[model samples]
Target: MQNEPLAYRMRPQTIDEIAGQQHVIGKDTALYKMIMNGHVPSMLLYGDPGVGKTSLAFAIAGTTKLPFIALNATKAGKKDVEDVVADARISGKVILFLDEIHRFNKLQQDTLLPHVENGSIILIGATTENPFHDVNPAIRSRCGEIKQLKRLTTEDVDVLLKRALEDPDKGLGKTPIKITDDQRLKIADASNGDARKALTLLESTVFASFEENGVTVVENGTLDSLIDRVGVFGDKKGSHFYNLLSALQKSVRGSDTDAALYYLAHLLENGDLVAVSRRLLVMSYEDIGLANPAAGPQVLAAIQSAERLGLPEARIPLANAVVLMCLSEKSNSAYVALDKAISSIHSGKTGEIPSHLKDTHYSGAKELGHGGYVYPHDHKIGTFGGWVNQTYLPDNLIGTRFYDPIDAGEEKRLSAIYNKLEKFKKEK
Candidate 1:
């Protein structure tokens, strides 16, 4: 028999054979009972790649004795789907696994919904993209959603690596493979918590391992080279994604425009445009709030434009927005203020909004003097006198400055405005 690819060979045949995804697949769960009872639901498994979505579907098929038919949204068409449903009718019970189900256009997805709803076929749709956004609502409504968790924690990765190292039939046991503590740590590090990618990397390392001067072992050097060979990140789904996120956050915090730009490039090169846009959107407010309030708006607009115009054309607006954010003045005063407020609440220091600031729309509110609140915007010179409401920010912190403006274009104007406001206050 021809040797199967390590991915195929390593495919888990049962729930016991599976790794990770314990939250959903653990004992006596609704989904688990369905799998064991041969009555699994028409479901959608959504998460990052190589996190066992497809594997779980196959395991469900194996456990239920259901006829399994696999389709790819990237390739399958209306005709292909129709044929699968027709076959499922004769097969008695079927589990039709559709990979990258999000890529299916609306009409194609709509065709599957009726068959799934009527129980002609138990549909197992899988996608790396969020099904809530990417899957057609009609199809989504007909299926139970199972969100596969992303890779996290070294313990999870270690458990997976040890299993792969020991499983003789499916893992590196067929060949002479041994891992040192450093190699194990690096493997775990490289995987970021994704078992499939870790195993693949482990297999590659064993293949690369050779006897040097009659000393045959997969040591740290061989493992490092294999890690590089497996790619900058063995798990494209996990650590690599978060590493770039970390880099982006640090760039914004350190006010390094160049570093932020570099992180953007890295994310784009890895085909993670969505992640890049998301971080930029977050960094805009979290790191750049108040100092350059326009930064968040600009990032959001860029993302909208990118959605309207994709790839090469879209790249320009995205890059332009990133550069603008990097060059913009940054402040975390909003974050700091919220943190203080949260801490105060946690410490049981919560205070009610003063009567002057409270709503006066109700019947008895006017009698309670709620409507007597001063309108600061309508005051002469646009500055109210003795209108201080120290209920939320505390008496001592009433005028405490937080957002110190930098020399960026917009912030320079903001600083000037603040200076002018201070002069007015002094003259009052």
Candidate 2:
């Protein structure tokens, strides 16, 4: 026990000893009750590393007094899972803790389906990635419960730190170390809500302090070295990535510049340039179309700039585009118009094209009554040569209005000209 790392030594022996995750493991909660009753179903424990997934599994096995078989899915093969299943068959029941379960392929995961479906093995699959995307659907469906453990809060980290300092059997109580509340919080902040990481850093800092000053006091300078590195908290292929991208796009569409910038910072921090550029480009046309015609072009230019400049520097141009998109007069008129037109066609309202509007450049087209097409340029009205009131849509959809522009931004001036054209056609 003394040779084990501080994190391992400080593993919670019971559910009551587990810190954080009160929502799932608190008293009277379903999970808590399940463990207390010793009837835990097959479950997938998912979250960022060191937030007590393995600890929770151990706690459940301890409470249930079931034979706990631990195996890392990253390196474990079908044989390893089969061995556990075989043991469960002999022993009646077994709790198998498979860590990094996402690393297992479909074949490796399928090996446990039969045992899991039977009462042979109660599988507790743990992963940092989202189970829905990374785990096989068959394996996931068999796991009756999927609980997400969130990052540890500052308060939770504090509890762990204090417990470690005082626990004689499993922690640094023998070292007589002293850590201030502020210093403990700084360590927690640097840990990024990982309990294992926090305990590891605390243990290392204590050793460093003793080695340097021959004392057990951790100084601010000692911690500064360990916490300087940035810990990015996101999996690009997981749900966190999509959720952030959705927030960024929605913020821009809703014209909330500050919120857009906030989410953009997170994307840039995560090095998701492609998602940032793609989502911003979509926002330019989908949310700001026609209302601010220049917005789409400006966003395209920004995307090009970002692609050329690449990260760190790319955030500048992307930020500019995001601000412009959020501040621009917003409209979805063109998008809505296209959808309405498509709906009409899909609903079988598409009538035959006017014979005059059909191509007359082909041979015999004129003889087929595809002639006398009205040329709007021959009767140009405005300085730039506007069109006549000849029908461009199908005859049945002649009076159907689709592109209804709101009186916002550039659409206001265009709407005035459109109203004028309608009045002229009425008079004629």
Candidate 3:
């Protein structure tokens, strides 16, 4: 135990000892009562990395005094699952803790369904992704409940740090290490609510400080060095990645330039340029389409520039694009119209193309009545108008208008031209 990493050594042995996540494990909660009764149900634990999902699973095992079996979905195969199920069937009381459950494929997940349903094994699946999007719905249905663990607050992280410093058995309590309250808080803030990361940072800093002078007192400089090495509060591949991306896009959609830039910086700092570029491109079309016709092209150009320049230089163009996207007139008419049209198609709202709209360039087309197509150029009216009314859609969709332009950006001008076209066709 003394040789183990501080994070692992300091893992809480009971639910009450776990930090944060009171919403799920607090006394008097259904989950608490369930654990206390030793009637642990199969559950899915969802949250960002390092917020104590695994710890909670261990705590539950301790509370029930059941045999705990741990497996990582990333490495565990169908055979391993079968073995666990076999053991559970004989043992009668086994807790199967599967980490990174999102990595389990359909077949792998299905392997556990029978065992879970028959109550041979109590399964605790943990994942950082949204279970709805990542988990097999069949497996998800079998899980008695899905509980989300919230990110730890600064105060919660501080408590863990203090406990680590004072625990003589599993922590640095044997060492004469001294960390100021401000230093501890700084480390907690730097950890970004991840207790494992905070403890690891503290452990590493203590070693470094002790090595320097034989006295373990972490100074500001030593703490700063460790914090820099640990990077930021959130993992780029975890839920934080999607959350920040969502916030960035929403900020841009809401026309909050400051917020947009702030989220942009967060992504850029995390070195996720490709995701940032892809999202910006999407926003150009989905959120700002037809509002500023130039927005789409301008964003494309910015992405191209960023790709060519890279890094600090790339950020300039990306920043410019983010600002422009936020400030541009917003419109989702095109996106909404496309979806509406697709929905109609999916609902069997389609019909054969009008004869005149069929291909006329092919052989024997005239015999098929394809040559009767009217040319607008032949009916020229004004400088811009060789206008003529014609059946451009299927017979059933002839009058089914889908593109409704919003009265914002260049769409307003487009709406006038469309209204005029409608009037001309009506008159004819």
Candidate 4:
């Protein structure tokens, strides 16, 4: 008999045989019922590789007893999809499983839409990429999406390892090597919630044990050797994302260029690059405003460039912008000014615009004495001092200054304005 790959050989023959994905395949779930009742919606299963998406697709096909047609979208195109749909229609019942569905271009994906809608073939798309960004909207809209959660917890991996070790027909039950709790836990840690990887690592380690112990027992050294060779990245979830991001943002806010660069590296390594770019853009406004007013536009420009170029190349511009934002002189005057203005308005402390400042756009406004305003341009001083009339600020903050400019490049001009406003207020 020809040998199948370990992944295929260990495939779950039934829903019960499937490990994890309890949210979708658990008892009485929509997916479970659909598989059991032959009403499975055309679905797009998205997750990192080795997380049971493809296995689930196969198990569902087997349970429904449908003629399963598999396609790797990387190699297939519009003509290939149309041929598959045409042949499947003749077969009466077919479930088309498209692996790496994101690889299919718009034209290729469009060919499958009519067949999916008409029920000629129930499409089951499996993708490793995030569906929101990778898949075309039209193709994605047609399929019900289920995210396959990454294998991260020890408990989930433990169950999977036990199953692989126990199943004689499918797994390495025939192997003489025995696994201890520590070995299993370490393997689980190494796999990082990826079951396929765990199994592969397990198989290799067991083979190593056989080589060393002569088909009788497995030792810790064998497991350790396997673990040493395997790499594991900790799960980036919950507070890790927010806490680390807060530090990065604060470093930039504090204008510590070195500290900001370190935090940027941490964010790039542990967090989403896109998320990092977004937070940096906000910090440009909240921390670097007016003092280096150009920081905000630079960050925005980097964001646009990053989207167009994607990672690696995108990383260069994003990193450059991040460093520039950190080194830029800090000022929150604009943010502070807006906050006070908003607070005053919220407290019902705002007044009508001075009649001189009111709109003169209409003839009726002019008739109502709206255009009887002194033109600042028409004055020799070209400044607004006596032009002020009715108060818009509250009693407690009538002349309360908010925007105090730093001695940074462009902000010196604003500092001059602040000085002029101060002198004018004193004269009044």
Per residue, candidate 4 scores C-alpha lDDT tens digits across 1-428 of 11655556777877787788788788868778767877878888877667888888888888888788889989987788888888877987588889988877877766888788787878889877667767777777788755554543667777878887877887777766566888888888888677778878877777677544545466888778778776433235433356567888898777677887877776676647778878888998898888888888989998889878876677778888878987778788888888977886798776656666678887788677775565544444554433442344445556766566677767878888778767765776
**What TM-score goes with each of the models?**
0.61, 0.87, 0.89, 0.61
Native-referenced Cα lDDT, model 2: 0.86
Candidate 2, 211: how far from true, in Å? Answer: 6.0
Scored against the true structure, residue 356 in model 4 reaches a CA lDDT of 65
Clashes of 2: 0
User: Which candidate, 1 or 4, has the higher lDDT?
Assistant: 4
On a 0 to 100 scale, what is the lDDT of residue 71 in model 1? 92
Output candidate 1 Cα RMSD: 11.6
Quick one: best lDDT, which candidate? 3
Give the C-alpha miss distance for residue 235 in model 3, angstroms: 6.0
Candidate 2 residue-wise lDDT, 1-428, digit = tens:
88999999999888899899998799979989878887879999998888999999998887888999999988898899889878988899999999988887776767877888986899899998888888878878889899999999988998999999899989998876767889998888888789999999888888877443544888898888877754666767666778789998899888899999998998888887887788888889999988899999999999999999998899889889999988899889989989998998899889989887888887999788887777888887868595777666787877788878789999898888878877776776
Q: Candidates 2 and 4: which is better by TM-score? A: 2
Candidate 4: the clashing residue pairs are 151-193
Clashes of 3: 0
Ranking by TM-score: 3, 2, 1, 4
Which portions of model 1 miss their true places by more than 4 Å? 211-216, 232-428
Worst 10 residues of 4 by lDDT: 231-240
Candidate 1 lDDT by residue in tens digits, 12-78: 7887666767787877577777677767888888776567888888888888777899999999989
**Residue-level lDDT tens digits of model 3 in 1-428:** 88899999999998889899999999968999988987999999998878999999999988888989999999999999999988887898689999988888777777888888888888899999999888778778879889999989999999999999999999988887878999999999999888899999999988888443555778889889889898665667777788899999999999999999999988988888898899999999999999898999999999999999999899999999999999999899888989999999999999998888788887999887776788888998766668788878897887898888888989899888888888887887
Segments of candidate 3 deviating more than 4 angstroms: 77-91, 104-113, 210-215, 232-243, 362-364, 372-374, 377-386
Query: Clashing pairs in model 1?
Result: none
- lDDT value, candidate 3, whole model: 0.89
